[model samples]
Target: MRLLMLGFNHRTAPLELREALAFDNERAAAALHELRQRYPASECALLSTCNRTEFYLARPIHDPPTIEHLRSFITQQTGADADAIHTASIHREQEEAATHLFRVSAGLDSMVLGEPQVLGQVKRAYELADGCGAVGPVLHRLFQGAITASKSVRRQTGIDQGRTSVSSVAVAFAKNIFDHFGDKTVLAIGAGEMIKASLASLRRENPKRLLLINRTQQRAIDLAKQLELTGTDHGGRAWDDMDSLLIEADIVVSCTGATEPIVTESRFKPLLKKRRGRPLFMLDLAVPRDLDPKIGSLRNVYLYNLDDLQQAVEATTSGRRELVNEAEALLRGHIDRCMGEIRHRDIGRLVKQLRQRLNDIAQEEQGRTAKKLASLNGQSTEQAVEDLIAQHNHRLVNKILHLPLSQLDRSDPDASMGFYAAALRRLFDLKDQPDMPMDEASSDT
Candidate 1:
């Protein structure tokens, strides 16, 4: 059996393409089953998130699927062409595939390095595939191992010690600014990536109210619905209602892509007067400054521009560089261990096949000898014949297993000995089988 991972990520594709290829739960599950139909021997799992869309498959295909196969599959599923899919990378064979999975699970491959969200997304993908019966023994083992490795890295390293992205940092800052988000009202000003990310972070605090206001009302409502699915107490209004929400909001994060400032001093001056000095934390995450710079000069207004938050993020990132290195080291060790087990399993399968072939011959000979001995049972010679047959069978067994036994002995000591041992049990139908007893199993190939 072999492992294959094919797909595109933020490194390869832009957000537009990634979003185009995004698969919801139902679609993802269906796509997995369809891929299995196209390659019946393959077990498949699809991972689709904001930053990437990847497919992990475990199969026995002698000529494994190529990048083109993946491209065609994606096109068929999402109606997108090859050109639309960027940075399409493929990993084949055991070691590379294992390493790739390890890195992904450890968050080393994430768009936002060390983000914890991807691990949960991967776990959910595996669960979805398993539920659809699209994951077999190989995939089941691979994903389970990946999940365990991720947990180990998190525990052993400081990769997740600090807030990394603007959204995460914003949420962390909010915690410091206010006692709790549960009682505060959050106003999301746009429906862009940053806004969505911030909303996700805000939801974690179990905020009492979330108001999404976007230039496009439908977009805002859609985001609201999505957040609601994640158990957020969310609602949405049009950009026209921004003034009304602003007066009531305790915290406001604006990430609009407007060419001019969306929230200028002129817009907030009146609201500030009406509110009479209620403290408001405003975060301008847009490139062009969604909130006017002068807004920071207002009384009781704690305004942070993108540069300020970015500086904080950079500081935190520098402090965690050592942790990233440690996490990577942990990931490498896990990859090595998982690959070793896979190699051992492969060898065991080969040994089992060889043993089964020999056992078939032994069974045939035993049947023939028993029939012939029945005819000669009229004489005491039957006892002599039985003893002779037993000796012959013993010699045949030794001769058949000679090569495997020898190879096992000469092979690397730490190499998967279980592979050959498992083969012996499976092929010979051995009851209460013992270890290959390296000395005996490796006598002579």
Candidate 2:
């Protein structure tokens, strides 16, 4: 069997280029159907996510899909330029294909290293391929192996200690400080990517109230509406209300690209008193410091600046490097087990062919012997057929074993062929059977 994996990821292409080649659920199903029709012999699975698009293919060794075929199929489905797609693509074959899949499934190759969402995305893709009937023996084993490897890596490593991204780390830190999010109020500053990621993570926790304030009032309104948190007095407000907003908020995530500190200690000190000593967790994700550094030391106030977050990023980044080596060592063990299974399964086909060839030869010899017995002995047709059928069983076993016997006999005086003959006899269970030996039954043939 032949196996191939090809794809592009966040590292290999830009977002605009990735979007041009992305697939929705309906498109994914249609793409599989079209690929099956074009190459019926090949089993195919496609994994498309925000960060990557990967295709896994399996077929007979002689009928493997060419690189040109992959390029054409992608171009047809996504309308992406062939040359551009080629430039961004990564291709792997056989064992290397399985290795790449294992790494990706384990989230080692994610845009944000060790991100957990990728495993779920990959699982959904595998389920889709199974539903489409595109997963044959090779692909099925490959996916199962990848899943096992990923699970092992997660269980064995500390890669998921933090959420692995600045925004996600901010959410994790917030979660750690609060006992529950049911009554928490989150005031998000700036409507940018980091803020959006933090909002998405918070929404999963189901906070009581979410507020948005931005320099551009309309941008805040738009984000509030997008999050379905738009309301008269609760959702969107102008940046001028920062002092009043901080007094009511339990958590604040600021990601605006400001040149100077906006939330000074003097401006925030009065708000802390108004908060009645209630704890407030503030995350400063912006460059040039959105909040003053002195504000961090205030009573009932916990502020994590950009420098703090950077330290976290540096720790996780360095930690991931050490853990990745451990993960790869663990993955190799799983890959070896999968390769062993594939080798055993591949032998099944050859065994079937060998048996079928031997049966055909025995039937031909049976028919010839029956005709000769009828012509010379004047035997009835039924009697001749019954006699020949018994002989056919004997001939089948002998013919099946003829090659091993011949190889055993034509040997040098070194006696090496003796061991070969012993193995052949054991393989056919000739010693344990009730039937006479081929060498002893001289006239039976």
Candidate 3:
């Protein structure tokens, strides 16, 4: 088995490049379908968020996909600039890929360290890929192991002691902007988990008004009820009225699942006159960015995207240094265990192939021997003699398999069993060659 991971994160790429490559749920599902079409024998899962966009793949070691292929695929799917993708990409293979994923799932690599939201994001990504039938044994095992490691870290350490998510950091930024929210009108666009988390954090600040608007009004209404925003100052509003609400909003947080910008310069430029130059604090927390980049240029507007919030969140990583170290150690242990399991699984596949090949050979020879004996005797064999012959054939096959099976089972830390497995495959011609005809391949016993 071989694993490949190629993508960019907040540390390696700018927000513009990351946003250009980010995949929402629908886009991610479609990309997975395309990947399957392009590489049927391979497995893939895509994990895309505001801070990162990653593609994880599993293929036969002999049939690996190159970094260039992944770059081309992502560019084609997202229509991102090829040069930007190439410049910002970070590639990992085999165990390194596994380790990266483990760290990501456990929130060790998040912009806000030990953030709980990324673990859920990882699970959602795995579920989405699995639902699309893009995940096979390798990814299923890898993601599940990563999730288990994440849960273990959360349970074992105090890494999540204080405000530790992007939403919380956004809230912190809001607080720094305003001494209090009593006089401010807070308008949150879209009702995703991140928006809800941000709103929840803001609710504690006791904003004068909280308004939520979503493309699907029902979701906004449901979220409003869940957050208990039943008062006159807080409630769910219709999508058609969002523009008017935006004009009145003093603090705006927009995080939607939209693939394109919802608030553009042209749309908001006309609304600026209605606000009469009142300061607007807007946060665009969505991955394809619900708010347009050009809107940040407008006067009397303080705009912040994910990258800006990342800078502000970095300073809040105090008091968790020891916990972060402990989490990393735990993640390393998990990575080692996961890699060991993958190796065993790979070896098991080879062992099964060898056993089936030997069994097929034995069965074919036994059939030939029985036919020859019958022809020589010119009579059918008795049940007792047939049973005796079958027992003798089983004993002979076991004797032939014993030495190689024993060698495979030998534990040698200095030696790689992969070498032995590859030798066995080459020696027996057990794995079909690339040039071999499909119909001519030996049938499994």
Tell me the deviation in Å of residue 284 in model 3: 0.8
Model 3 lDDT, residue 7, Cα: 80
Cα TM-score per model = 0.58, 0.58, 0.81
Which lDDT tens digits does candidate 1 get at residues 169-281?
A: 88877766788877888999998767888988888887788889988999998988877733445677877888988998989999875646788898899998777677888
* Candidate 1 runs further than 4 Å off: 61-67, 83-87, 168-186, 189-320, 365-445
Better of 2 and 3 by lDDT: 3
Model 2 regions lying over 4 Å from their true place = 169-197, 200-319, 377-445
Q: In terms of TM-score, which candidate is stronger, 1 or 3?
A: 3
Model 2 scores a TM of 0.58
lDDT, candidate 3, equals: 0.87
lDDT of each: 0.77, 0.79, 0.87
Q: Total backbone clashes of model 2?
A: 0
Q: What digit string (tens of lDDT, one per residue) describes model 3 on residues 144-260? A: 999999999888986765746787777777766778889899999999888899999888888999999999999998999999998888989999998999999999999998878
Please give the clash total of every predicted structure, in order.
Answer: 11, 0, 0
Best candidate (score: TM-score):
3
Superposition error at 113 for model 1 (Å): 2.0
**Candidate No. with top lDDT:** 3
